[model samples]
Target: MIKSPTAHEISYGLVELNPDGTIQRANDEAKRVLISEDGDSNYLFHRITNNEIKTKLHECFMGRANEFIVTIDNQPVFFLFHRSNNEQSQDRIHVYLFNIYNLLTLHDHNNWNNHLLSSIGEMAAGIAHEVRNPLTAVKGFLQLMEQTYKEEYSHIAQSELDRAIHILNDLMSVSKPEFVQEEKAAFNVCSKIESILLLFQNQLYDINVIKSFQDETAMVVGRRDQIKKALFNLIKNAIEAMSDGGTLMIEQYEDGHDVHINISDSGVGIPKDKLRLLGTPFFTLKQDGKGMGLAQVFNAIQSNHGKIRVTSEEGIGTTFYLSFPKKSQYSTQFIGGNTMLQVVDSKTDLTDFLFKNLDFYTREWVQYLEKNKSYITSLLKENGEMEQYDRAGNPIMKLVAQNILEIKTELIMDVAKERGVKSAKTEFPMHLAWELFQSSRGIIWNAIKSFYQESQNTLSTEEFFTLERNVNDIIDLYIDSYTAYYVNYKEDLLKSHRETVDELSVPIIPIAERVCILPIVGNVDTYRAKKIREKTLVRVKELKANQLIIDISGVPFVDTAVVNHLFKIVKGIKLLGCSTILTGISAEIADTMIELGIEIDNELKTRSDLQQALQDIQQFRIGKD
Candidate 1:
């Protein structure tokens, strides 16, 4: 009697062979993928040329090993061999074959990525020096001009030149760190990691975060900001990997000698062959990435006396295991706090606990603020503002709760600024606003204490402080943004009172038919520079000018930023079919431009003074006529 074929035989190219390597039976897939056109069963066994693979297959028949890979006709194939357990029939080998062509293609791509990254690192320093040399020489000339002239414009020019040089220095530092350096300090690894995680709160709505932070005082000696930036990139990558939403597991623990942080994600895992190319510069799996993120991460880890190991299986997930040599230090207590930010990674539990008691804390906060019955407070009370304040606490607490739950603070601060501006518009007393913000901190801390007691005091010292700092830091930021906006709005009102209506306008005077003169007389700041660009184009088009003469003779100074603004204005004017003739090139201004390495635009006509510019324009008109 004949038996039915298994699923493996139907799906894959399956073939059954006797112990002596003779063909028993072949599936349709097996004939198409493994067997030759002659339809001989011996061809399958004879195709595997590797002696090691042959030995492994022989062992599979003897009931020892069951999996082996072999190359047949320059193509890699996977074979799964199993011995049949049938009492009535003879012992046979059941082999499942699969083609792994795509995987090898990916391997080839990663190898190319690795080679390209090596070339970039070697060329970085050369590029930096080649760009910086001209700027350095120009800066030297500008210094001499500043000494000879003792002008304010040269000082402005020098400042802008320094900024350009600084950027080049930073580029060189990232590419070749020994060329530039930073100081390393001992910082709380757990708290830093927690803070970085908070930056990704909005993206975590669909993600389930599981944090297992055992050692809160896991100190790592490194450049604090650089390490933070590196961790931010790694976490950002982890979040991007899970587009469909999955588990994000962040664990931090310590052995006797070292502290370890394991960041794992249940996303599309990286293939084994491509893992080595992960930190290579300009290499990325994501569609919209510059690829410097992981490169910086790798550089930071190594520079900070840390090691990173990664393990991943395609379609399963990936984990980054980072170990740093532990820096042993006694915990110091922060003033007004339990212990100095020895924080744990119990983000989910702590956030949920605070949210559960959010209402109680909100009421306590409003009641405390209401005790201040001053004139502003009394006026607000009559306007039903107390209820509004009470109502506002819920959403604010939700934002703060999101912060504790590990979310970004940008939206929270934006809301804070809006509220601050509204308070200013209502003429609310700044001190009373301060008191309102100050009182909430105490109420939230009280709620945290209740959570601790209710949970039977099981919270670790580090875990308690982590929650404390997270709450305090967020409230402090809210207070800063709130107060800043309030004061800025009031100042803007005062500045408006002092200025005349005409002073707010950009001065554009029409000189001739299809020609205009914009004589700029005072210092041009970013705000005024933008206004200048807007009005100049409008006036030029209104007058139907073919030439716009911008005379900056009376203007005090032009920095690098002002130069950029002026260049943009010129470019815009050209796009509108009008020409710009710039006059008043002072010696100080000339030196500044040289130091900034600014090139004169070919379309722009420059002259020593307005008189010379008008002469050239008249001559050009005569020539055209």
Candidate 2:
């Protein structure tokens, strides 16, 4: 026969006291529940059983209330006592206990759900408030424009109307409470940031914003407009934080499977207490702030399955960090097989590619060094060589060494790039290389200390000194070699560029006596172009130059703003009594310039080659003489 289920077999000790409340026998369950294995059962029972409950039970036995129910640790139980009129008159009392763990669990679940719903509702309200004002302004402007422009200017009015409508559309998109469907697309992050900066050009100028971007490109998978909105919020907050004057840094990088965007400000940092509440819906530190900027940032990041962290010190500054998942090759080319094929085909084989481009030069250099190893060895052996090396290892040497370390850092970056990692450039800062070196040194020092402590033979004082000197010498040589190699490589690259520049004889002759060639390198945005123009003008006047050649060969891309600034430079140079020749119009640059609707052909002299510019300038000078 099956035994009764243990559910019922489970028992608690029952304590029944004399009418005077003397000692009573304790049941097994009560004993197990109230006392430890070695605890006194009588003492525990007396101490744990409620005095009021016992008194009330006695009263109930004497016919006060018929029954009573009470909770213990949120568990409900019933206590019943009966008194008989017979001669013995023994008191009969029973205790009934019930478990309510499941009930408590249900209650907690309901509460949590309610709290979550309330939070979502609050977020929705905050979003509506944040977006409605901008939308109202856009709508009002469009309506005014429509009314103001009757007939002839209707086309201009319509263009403005379309722009207003786009703004409203974007506002609606961001303000919606629902999660936006993910649209993973391959887009250049730097280009997107540049576009956003362009959108805020007026504000940037009014505030005298200073910005710098590393000359690198980052590609990521994201909703471009949404990310732009997030970045705008971050930057706008930063600008507001430094109302009088401050610096803002917007940087991106890739680490492992993550792409990070950092927006930092050199302004009054968030208070330590306020930092934790940065992304909360209604949290604000500024008097006039609505506090929705970071909330929206939170939503955007959450929508993208990303994370955000903020660190701030009271007097120092604040840094907001956002991390997005780095897109993989498979995700980047999810649309068509042809796209995947194109990506794969375009990728160069690492071994073959590195060898083909850099290996021959690297190998030749290595061989030359190997052949001259004795000379370097002799230098290394010279007395006080280590000290000399240490003394010469100044900032310039450090910078050069750092640059070499940066090149070697490509080993890490190449892995990320091959995997189609987003924000790879931003993630690998030069400091990380230095940190790695420090870590390696720590490991080496620890090993040496451990060996010294355990060594069977003790080192002589002279031997110890010699070993220390040798280690120092080794470190000095390594650093010096790295610095020398980096400097030499950079010099070689510049030398190559100079040779190429020398071959092209453009029309405008370099005023060797007065003018200096300030060839603008990298992508030229409007702000950079303006700065270049201003700086060149000042230099030209100071040098008392008669001619200037604004070389564009080093420029990788051109936009309308760039072309406009070039025109401004031409005007500025003319004001300084210097003729300007715009040289090195590559096919790509010409195409982009034309696309920008710029009339560079008439505004300034252009040459396909630098030689033509030099010739034209010489001829002009001779004629003038």
Candidate 3:
């Protein structure tokens, strides 16, 4: 039979750069990897990004470092380079690229889904199996409502609730991985094998029953009855295979914390094709076979935390090995509730277990978000748009995933700090920080809640408490750390805002050709007076202004010292061939100026208001003609 292909080819791109760091050659995939639109390879990276990628690529040549993941076109990709010495140029770089988007998409589409539409169609066909009872109940309720109200329109409310039932039916079609709660307890494998031996003792009269007990270390963490039934099936098959007479060998031993039971039989062995399908449902090689024996045997072992492997050659013999973790209830060091966590952690594949189930965690979080979708959306939307918070593929989710892969708390804090600065600079406010923190907490809690829901009922009292406390502590730690980073960044942002506002107060407005106005607003204290003098001179020189208007209409307070500083500013402007045009002189300011020996006319020109000064400058041909 021809089998459909269920695998995908991983995509890769390569580029060879000259010793001097210029692109020499690139393949079609390389152009795609670089997000090049024109398909040109020459000076590509330079044209695309700053020298950041070039620098990082060059660093790959240093020492033995050859590969690392880098973000190219806003997605992570494996950046690898081979440093080979070039005869014509410097060190030649052979670049290789493989991005995360393609890898993850393949895992999602090709590996995860095979004929999804077909499966959905099949599920739709069986939809009646699930919705039958619900529909019956709803129909009965709707009839009751109609009778009670004595009107057909009265049951419209009950009828409308059919959408929820439809949704429930839809959920059943999507297969979530079956997570069976494992109840761990010490059970003797040798005892189970012995029981099977006793059960088959009378039946295996023609066969020679040879049993080997190797040190009797047969304790494993599983239900004993399941093991007994599975072992009995294996032993019975062995006995049945040998109709005339044959040796049925049974051996049990423990290797470290793993218990192994090996069963062998010299009988009419199974064929290669049938051997592979031995445990498949309704599959059998025997003439008088129900086909549920091996399937039940496989399920019994699998359900009780055990793995079974079968090896056989036709007309020779068949051997089976059942392996399971040796019980460690009394052996392990007992702590508080953490005992359960320790057991799970020990049994856990620390490498892939967490990652393999990350989708489950994310899905749970998304479901939670949807549950409160209305409230969250209302809180986030501002001016008809969500305030930095997106319902799909949001930054918080992306960051959480990255953190799941690597402990990027410090990196995250740094980014938060930078965000604070940008937020402060952009006036994005501190509430956004809190928003991300709160939403992330919601996701984390949802994940923990789901995990607890799945296993809490099956865990020991000690393990359950330990798991809850650990989850709480982790959440508290995140809250404390994230708050610290956000607060620090927010403070920095506030400080930057203050400095910016202060700088903006001293306004420099360019009016006409070679003329600028320095509108000094509010009270001119000693500090403001000093800044005014310095900034005025800098503006005049920078703008090449021949004239400057000192508007004091906005300043309510002017002391004798401030008057002297004005004269000094005029003198400084004279030195630069830029004349000072003073405006907004009141009667109070005129008396102070007279006391300082300053002439209002010509010596130090003054006007009642800014319009008068500009008109005077224009009349005298000093302003832009």
Candidate 4:
């Protein structure tokens, strides 16, 4: 029986590479690896599932690495590159194809299956014990109600009991070893979805559910209950999101190859950092949330060979795109009695070919930038980084070229995972980053198209789509990375500016030689009052002022803390060898100051207004003269 279809379990191909990273010779297995299994036709070599192997192999040859290990599609594969010893060959490397899981015996696979079953049994037994107590309590309550002839009380009790049962059932459903796939049944998903929506109609009372159907009924091949369970998890999630009452949208549509159902909720959206971790077991954003709901959702979909994609903006909302490949008689994988999902591993080799001509592609990228100078110019305008853009022979253009030349598909994805705010703020902001990527993508694709045209004659439709997707992946990777970083950078920039403004909110202004005014113009909270004290003392020392006047006429109220701060400022100024003057002591401020037991120092002068203080300073200076 076929167990896990890991990458190691799949066939391997050996392709010899010269020192310069050019393909020297490919054996039969390599051709098979490149081609689709159905026709043995040449598939795109760059489209291989673990194509990172090729990049690592190339890196080893380039002397960048001696060994590379990577896990692709859940299978870990590694490569060891060795230098060939020969008088004739100056630089040659031999790479052996080794299967990581080849060490596993048949007995080990059986042991895994046994261990999984035992774990399930243990969990089920625990659940049984918990439910038994509740079940016994309900039985006793029913007997009491029956003896009392209390029909209304019985009904209320029964209703609550039913709710408990429902919740328990939901728990049990998620805890089961399997997410419950219907082994036999073909049903239209349209009806199932409508039924589930109607069930939630009352629950979504304040929430608007907008439903759009491009394909009214989808012919899904699988268990209807299983599909419904997944749909229930998603819709329940949607309902939970709208606590504040927002729109919940469900869109069902079909493209040529797959059916898509998008469920979107206008609620507190997830951040990108948290979005990456959505479907993991016991992970949820909700308060005291268990991941059972989404776990079941993911399990059901995976059981039926479906794919899920999620996109969310922090404030806007979240939308989930669930795709089920059009169930066909032609495409199905069978392991034992279970039907497994077989994704069409359509890929393109043109990427490897393109990687070889990095300089050529870089020039193409530059030509692209030159063509779309107007757009690039618009993006650059008004960005502060523009001053940072004086070209060292057009640094932006050259950097775009370098990104293309050095990009392996894996690097594109790795960049996406890391390009969040910290990197984005330090490197490039979103608008500029996206503009650069979009411009470069056009050029990158143009270069890829040129390479494809060279071999387009023998390529199949699958091969062409593979090429299109791989090229699309390059742009997609850049844009995904660019957008994530952009969002974070914008957020960080806003937060930073807010902090800067808050820091500089309290201003000490110098109006005369060695004399300055510290204005307290707004509502003086404890925070602002503290800032005032800090800034005033620093200003007095910095200016070497003989007099420091604090004006509080614009202040609404002098609270107890504000009074304390004023007295402290007076004391601090005296220590700095400067006389302190209080101006704008309003009747209300004076009363509060008196109540707070604040007394001015004997040397400190109190002025009703700023004009009086300035006049006194002028007279005192004249008298000294």
lDDT of 4 at 104: 39
Q: Model 3, range 249-282, lDDT digits (tens) per residue? A: 9887777766778899999998875565666544
Clashing pairs in 1: 201-407, 514-545
- For candidate 3, give the lDDT: 0.62
- Give candidate 2 misplaced runs (Cα > 4 Å): 1-182, 202-215, 329-341, 344-625
lDDT of 4 by residue, 329-384 (tens): 31222111222221121122443555556556555555556566655554444444
lDDT of 4 at 291: 50
Which 10 consecutive residues of model 2 have the lowest summed lDDT? Answer: 419-428
In the range 93-166, model 1's lDDT, one tens digit per residue, is 78887654533344444555445555556446434444466567667768778678656657656665775566
Model 1 lDDT, residue 528, Cα: 74
Worst 10 residues of 3 by lDDT: 172-181
Model 3: what TM-score?
A: 0.30
RMSD (CA, angstroms), candidate 2: 24.3
Top lDDT model: 1
Candidate 2 vs. true structure, TM-score: 0.30
Where model 3 places Cα greater than 4 Å from the true spot, the runs are 1-429, 457-532, 539-547, 554-579, 585-605, 611-625
